[model samples]
Every structure is written in C-alpha cells, then in structure tokens.
Target: MKPDLPTDLTWPHTSINNNAHRVGFWILAHLTHDPAYMEKVREEIDAAYLTQGPSAEPDMGLLLCDCPQLDAIWHETMWLYNTASAIRKATRACAVGGKRVSVGDQVMATFRQFHLNRELFGGDAGAFRPARFLDDKSLARRKGYAPFGGGHTYCPGRLFAQREIYLFVAETLRRFYLELVGGAEGTMMPGVDRNTPSAAAMGPERDVEVVLSVQKL
Candidate 1:
C-alpha cells in the first residue's frame, strides 16, 4: 500500500531546491570571478579527499566538517545572496529597537539588511569576502547573521540544504575544471535580480556562460 504524504510536503522540496539552486549559482559565479579563490577551494577539497583514503571517494563527514574553505565559501554565499525575510508575531507588548511592539503585532526582519550591515560585519560587509567568516568565528553566532532563520522556527531542512550544496560543489570541482566562457576580462559579473520576489535566495539577473572540462586526474 502507498503511504500518505502530508499536504505541506512540497514546502521542504521547494525550499531546498529553489534556495540551493540560487545559492549554488552565486557560489559558482563568485568562483568564476576569482580563479585564485576557486583554486584555493579546489585544493581544500582535494586535500579532504586524499585524507579519506585510497578510493578518493568523498566522505560526508570530511565534506561537512573538515573543509574550512568550502564552509567559508558557503557561508559567504549565503550572506551575500540570501534575500529571505523572517516574520514573527509579538507574543506580548515589548520594545524593540526603541519601537513599541504591541501584543500579536507582526514584525518583519529582512536578511539582506542584516547581512549587509557594516557595523556587525565590518567595513567590507557589502563585499563578498569568504575570509570574513574564517577570520571571525563570532559572526556565525551573532544575532544578525540569520541565513536559515532562528529560534524555534529555524529551518528544519537547513542541514539537508547545506549538505546538498557542499556535495554538489565538492564533486563537481573534483571531476571538472570550470571557467567562464569569455574569461574575467571579457565577461562581467552578473547583477542580482532584486526585482523578483524571492522567499529565500535571490538569483542573478543574467545567465553566466561557463566552460567545463574533465579534470586530468
């Protein structure tokens, strides 16, 4: 007999697939923009694979835990590209940011504003610097860095989404070399499509053409 599925089953699938695609797109775009950074991430992935033993197969544990560069890239991508907003209702009367919040009042928090906040993220907050995350451990735990939401309503599929992006990036780079079709001088970085309504991650305004070749392993 077939098992029944819940009516909200599509929520997870939509959230994971849509947000992952957008996030992955930005990651690749940034990597293509900076070849040196790409090589750094590639080297990290290679080292992790080598440490996993002779088969050279990717170990989920290492991918999730061992590669600091990849982790930083992922975090930077989320910080720069995610446009998700968190909506919460005030359970009781309180003051936030000096604004009085009445009971049952709805408050919206925009991730983009927080992500781009110069005070919390430093002077280069608007820039896509993966090293920011690596250099500052406290940034991830800060109240302003809520890529997957927070509190009890935090995204349940966050781990799954992260794992999927990590595996995709690691495996793709492991077997292939990718570059923009026209090189950095000829091609410009795509702009964010802010005009579109995005529930999570936002996408590029234009498509970037890339050339992928099998690695000479």
Candidate 2:
C-alpha cells in the first residue's frame, strides 16, 4: 500500500497555480507595452513552429529549449516581479551578516534585494530589459536570480511552472494579437502592487484593459 503524504506536500501544488497566473499576466502586460519586443518574440515563436511544418503542433522540446527570446522574457519577468521569500529556522545557533542567531530562530531572505541590486544586475536593474538575460546567460545562474527561492527548499515544481507559462504565452501570442485599449496612455506599464503580503509573484497595482484580435494565418 502507498503511504499518504503530508498535507504540506501540497504547498508546491498550490504555490505553482497561484504564481504562474500572476507571472503570465505581467509577462503579457510587458509584451503589450513593448510592441517591438512583442513582435520579435512572436516572430521567434512563428519560426520555431515553422521549422516543425505548417500543420504541426508546438513541440515541447522547441518550446522549452529553442526559444531564447521567450526564455529571456521569462527570466526578466521573474527578476522584475518575483516577491517570494525564503524562510528557514535555525537548528542550532549561528551567525548571519554579522548578526548572532539563537537556536530555532527563523531567518527570511527576500529575493528582491538581490534581484534589484545594481551591483548584480547593473545600472538599469530597475528597468524591465529581457535582453540582459539573453546577452548574458550567466545572469540566470547567478545567486541574484533566485525566483525559485534557494537551497534544498528550492521550488520542486519550477520546471513544470515554467513550461506552463511558456506554453500559455507562446500559444496565446501565436493565435491572437493583443494590444492595450487606449492610445498613448494605455501603453504605459502598470505599477507593481508591492504592498501585498509576501507572495510567490507580485501583481499589478491597477488593471489595464487590452483588446485581443485573432491572428490571421
């Protein structure tokens, strides 16, 4: 007989669902804000599927490995919007950053501090520039890019969550053209709602309406 898993084991399941949607929303919003970048990504998606054949469906291998632009956007989105924190309790007394910790003390590490650090991400760390990841692959592997938390507790479903977002963005862009509703003002990027209690992903402070038109084949 199979043994039942602990209820907390469901945390990753719930977390991925909660996080993926928010991440996807911001990704789409960022793409809409930059039409040139959107078109570039769309073209990359088109090219990927074209290689498979005119009547073929998307290949998981291509989606996961072949699309560098899409992957860069995903990394940048995580850098700009991820607000998740890693928390751990001390089994024994220890020191961190010159501070002494008592046994059983809980320590929380906020990802944004590293993500937005100019030293790590450069002068435009505050800006949403996906090319940074594309230009420098090492950026994603750096300690600063910890969207999935870190150490042994690193997110177990990160790969699944990434594929889910990638498929969502690729298919949506391939099938439809999305644009912000208003003229100039609508193109403005929405402000992030940083005040929300600690979450796996940050959300927009205000809603921005968008119009979607079916793409012509």
Candidate 3:
C-alpha cells in the first residue's frame, strides 16, 4: 500500500501463503481428530472424483456449485474455530441493548463471542456440526457467521482465499492419505486466545502436528 515504493508482493504473498498453510493444518487435524468426520470427507471426495480418476484434476465449477459435504465442513471449520476479528467505529452515537455509545467510540467485533452465540448457533453450539450449514441455507448467512468481513469492508481476496483452501483439501485428498502424528486422537482441543485473532489466520492456541501418507493413484 505504499505509493513511494515500487509494487511488491513479498509481504502480501507471505501473509496469504502462511494463512493457507495454517488452514490446511487445521482441516487435516479436524479430520484426524474425528474419524467420522474424516470418513465423511473421504466419502465426499471419492464421490466427487469418481467420474474423473484419482489422478485427474477436479472441476472447479462442480466444487463451487454442488459439493455439499466439502462446503459444509469448510464452512463449519470457519464458523466454529475461526479467530478473525472485525473492528468497527461508531459513525453516529447510538444505544445497543441498553448500552449507550458515542460517535467516536470504537467497537471491536470478536468472532470468539459472535460466532459462538448460543441463540444463533443453538443448544449444541459448541459442537462441530457441519450439517447446520447444509440444513439451513436460507437464514444461515443472515446470522452470526462472518468468517470473512461482510458488506463494504469484505476481504478483497475472498474468492482467491476460498479457492486456495479448496485446492489444499482437494489436492491432498487426491495425493495423500492423512494420519495423526501421535496416538493422541481427538482427545483434546486447543485453547485459543479469544481477545485477539490474528490477521488471515484462525486456529488453535498451540500448534498441532499432522502426518500424511502418499496414496496410490
């Protein structure tokens, strides 16, 4: 964003690339931690690529339009574990739920609070249920989910970000079979810092290690 300097993407590229890697890790971890979920993903992926051989490339259009299970898992991942924060400033003074705010006041919208709202996500809100998204298509987008910022300030790289993440899942399914590093399965979930979610990254409090084995094509 510097006008004085020549156009360079070293920083932007690094940031986006790192985020993609983190997303890949989280997806694999979730799949490993929950064998049932992993089976669901494998079934979906296998069905998706049935017409085209394992070595064949996936059709992006089919993925974007009709891949239900993949879409569910990806959306649920962001809905449940995302750590992106959106900060907004009050343009005009107003009252919110009996709380008053001034024009100059700044409001931070933390996903930790909003995404996990009991009323919005329902009773089993804490559970990782991808079916919610699959079941409710009408009212889901209007609720507490905002993995990427919405409205005018939405992430410009949203499409690219999605495609990149999809490629990670699709390519890995085609090339490698995922496995957990240690015997520790879905025994524990990491603690995350709810106060501040990093830029373009939404994940656990600590790092998770995963292993993948090459599959015969």
Candidate 2 local distance difference test against the native: 0.85
Which candidate model has the greater lDDT, 1 or 3?
Answer: 1
Error of 3 at 7 (Å): 5.7
TM-score, every prediction? 0.89, 0.90, 0.79
Model 1: per-residue Cα lDDT at residue 149: 85
Each prediction's number of clashing residue pairs: 0, 0, 0
Order of candidate numbers by lDDT, starting with the best = 2, 1, 3
All models: lDDT? Answer: 0.84, 0.85, 0.71
Predicted candidate 3 versus true structure: per-residue lDDT over 1-217, tens digit per residue: 8578647977568558656777666776677778787777776666656466555866677766667777887777777666667778899999977989899898777765777788877787868788888888753485668877676767678788778888778777667876656745335656554565466566566665667788887
Once superposed on the true structure, which residue ranges of model 2 sit more than 4 Å away at CA?
1-10, 50-56, 183-185
What is the C-alpha lDDT profile of model 1 across 105-183, one tens digit per residue? 9999998899999988888898888998899877788879989988777898889899888878887888888878876
- Stretch of 10 with least lDDT, candidate 1: 47-56
Q: After superposition, how far is residue 8 of candidate 1 from its true place, in Å?
A: 2.1
Root-mean-square deviation per candidate: 2.6, 2.4, 3.8
Q: Which candidate is the best by lDDT?
A: 2
Q: Which should have the higher TM-score, number 2 or number 3?
A: 2
